[model samples]
Target: MKFAKYGSITLITFVLVAGIAIPLSPSPQNWLQFPVIPGLEEKARNILYHVPVAWTTVVAFLVSTYYGFRYLKTRDIDYDIKSVSAAGLGFLFCFLATVTGALWAKFNWGSFWNWDPRETSIFVLLLIYGAYFALRSALETEEKRATLSAVYSMIAGITVPFFIFVMPRIMTGLHPGAKEVADPAAISKAQAIADSAIAVGSKTFADSALATVAQMNVGSAVPVVQLKMSPNMLVIFLLGLLGFTLLFIWLLNVRVRLARMEYERSTHHE
Candidate 1:
């Protein structure tokens, strides 16, 4: 287990750098052919890193909640400790994701804070988990703390999907997959760009494609920018996802061990 944890960490680090360092396209100027998203351009590189971190946060929270549920059923202190450790790491990853996302927003949206639906939802999620720690801290007895924390984690789990995925998609936001974006016209436009970018190799194809979209005097107030990643981009994205997932697993293992040690020491002193 130890070898797997540390060995994977070294391998993942190399893979992550490779994903980030490799240019989006074989031809730098013709990045449009390689999954350089229409509006995002160079900024799309963040997608490789930012998205995986967000996903890891979700996985961590889910694991935390599962352990919390187990603790409730078994009344085991170890399960409670494991739950807290997972949650603590989850919150850390969530904060990192938010920070990276905000930086991306600063470049993409021209502001550090935009109150975008996705951003708002993530903030609310932070508060929900933040309250989890606060509630744990307030309790004096072990049983009370464990029971209430487990209950709160279970409740928070229910809101995870709603906040992270559902609510953001329901309301029109900068995120993809919104109501307006799902329209037929947007899909066709995205397909056209992809087909053109692949068939014709030149900067002009991208410029003309974007120009056509701009000229289309759309009826909607908000512009619909579809994200179409190329095959090369998809490969990098998958590598990043794999690396981040392994990193999360390694970190979670280390964190749980440390938490167990701390719990043992505290109880020993008491």
Candidate 2:
């Protein structure tokens, strides 16, 4: 446990330094080069910090749900404690991801609250977990509380994939990998096709746009596609991911131990 704790601290320090120090791909004077992203430029560097935290949030929730399920099967209060603890941490990371995403949006899109489908999905997720805590507080009996909370967490788990994956692709939004192929080159090609269609009056602009998109292989799947990172950026991102994962493990260990102590104390007094 100590090894995990200290290892996480060490790796997180490395992540912070490398993430901040690595040079982003520079804007080219000509078309032969691409900035990490055409419009995002240096702000694209947020991928290092933002994506890892977001990934961690999903991981945290999944782990929490796993423990919740375990509690259902074993009727172990310890699992219940773990479920809540993991969910608590997941909420924190989700908040961080949202804040970082908003900052990234403000930098790239000139607005902090565009209500993009991805953004809306996260908001709804927050509310879902928020209710988990509320329901937890409202109940007084230990066994009943554990059982119901476990069930509720499972129900909430159903939405996790939908919010993070499904909803974003189905709605047009400003976030990268959303429903739109907003890449500069793709957009330009789409526009040219639309214009030519309008001039010839042989096809609808929408039809021309769809044809261009199909020709370019642009689709909802493309927006949510993974960003292709340069070798250096990829290494740093992987290190950050490793560091955060270790941190989550260390935190879970600590929380579970504390919960065990509390549970023992309460039982002893009873």
- List of clashing residue pairs for candidate 2: 177-223, 177-224
Model 2 scores worst on lDDT over the 10 consecutive residues at 27-36
In model 2, where do residues sit more than 4 Å from their true spots? 25-36, 181-226
Candidate 2 local accuracy as lDDT? 0.74
Writing each residue's lDDT as its tens digit, candidate 2 over 1-270 gives 998899989988987877666555564343233345544556666887888888888888889889999999999888899998998888888899899998876544444666778789777767877888899999999989889988998998887788778876665565556666445555555566556555766453445344444433555445532457666667777988988888888998898888889989999999
Q: What are the lDDT scores of the predictions, listed in order? A: 0.72, 0.74
Deviating ranges (above 4 Å) for candidate 1: 26-33, 181-223
Checking candidate 1 for backbone clashes, the offending pairs are none
Cα lDDT of candidate 1 equals: 0.72
In angstroms, give how far residue 267 of model 1 lies from its true place. 2.2
lDDT of 1 by residue, 155-245 (tens): 8777767766677666545555444533445445544664565476645445544443453335254444566667667776776677777
TM-score of 2: 0.78
Cα TM-score of candidate 1: 0.78
